[model samples]
Target: MKTADIQPFFATLKAANPSPQTELEYTSVFELLAAVLLSAQATDVGVNKATRKLFPVANTPQAILALGLESLEGYIKTIGLFRSKAKHLMETCRILVERHDGQVPDTREALEALPGVGRKTANVVLNVAFGQPTMAVDTHIFRVSNRTGLAPGKNPLEVEKQLMRRVPGDYAVDSHHWLILLGRYVCQARKPRCWECLVSSYCDYSPKTPPPQGSLR
Candidate 1:
């Protein structure tokens, strides 16, 4: 996408939803960290469902550590890879308690050092929790970035970097949220609803998909 187009592209998205936010539900930074850690290969709705039951009981790292692996698994077993997620959560809690005073780390390096945390997770934590203008390209964001020619790249890291560079400073903070929502709902993988997409004008995709024939909503 051209530099001039990029501003309007993000501007349209920002206009649609002035205050975009992550769909994953959380109260404290610890809860957000745990939710993101568990969100890999899972939907936000699914993660929120599990966390809704888990948070009240163990919202803190120390509390989750005390919850024990077995009980923790019981709470999140409905989520995919729950067993491994539970294990990672337990070890992460231990590390947080032992190293960081049971608090979620703000820096990428420290966040990535946790058992289940990775570059994407660290980026998300840094962005959502600390209000950093970081991009965490997941499957949805990746697809949208490429399909829209906003920041096409071969991998998540590349796309993230491209987004960091291409996105306007004004939209940098909430761009991830906007792209994620757009991909999840409008620019879907199976069949993009380009007809209703707000930024379709700026999108570089050819043969934009129209709404179902002879139907209007």
Candidate 2:
């Protein structure tokens, strides 16, 4: 998309949600890191449901360390890969206390060095918790970027680079959330609601999906 088209794309998103935030629920950076780690291949709603119960008892690295792996597994066993997630979470907690003074690190290298944290998860932590302007290109973003011609790429790394270069400066910080939310709700995987999309006029997609039949709206 052209730079001109990009302006209005973000303007609409900013106008609608002046201060958007991650749907993941967490009080501290430690909790945020833990929540994001568990969110791999799982929904934010599911992660939040589990974290809500877990965080109340142990929101910090030290606190979670005290919870022990068995107890931690009990809280998050409902999520996928609970056994592995529990192992990683406990190891990450140990690393945090031993290396980063029980706080989540700010840099990508330091953050990714933690057990089970990947590029996408690190990007989320840096962007949301540390106010870094990084985009974590997940499935939703990859699909939207390709479909809308916003930041087309063959892989996540390529898409991340494309977004970094294409997204306007004013919107780069919030683009992650906006694009993810848009793709999750509007530009869905099965049937994209292109006709009702706010930026449909600017999108370069072919054979756009029309509005649903017999809609009240």
RMSD of each: 0.9, 1.0
Worst 10 residues of 2 by lDDT: 208-217
User: Any idea what lDDT model 1 has?
Assistant: 0.93
Lowest summed lDDT window (length 10), candidate 1: 208-217
lDDT of 1 by residue, 143-217 (tens): 999998989999999999999989989998999999999999999999999988999999999898877988684
Candidate 2 C-alpha lDDT tens digits along 64-96: 899999999999999999999999999999999
Q: Against the true structure, whose TM-score is highest?
A: 1
Candidate 2, position 208, lDDT: 84
Please give the CA lDDT of all the candidate structures: 0.93, 0.91
TM-score of each: 0.98, 0.97
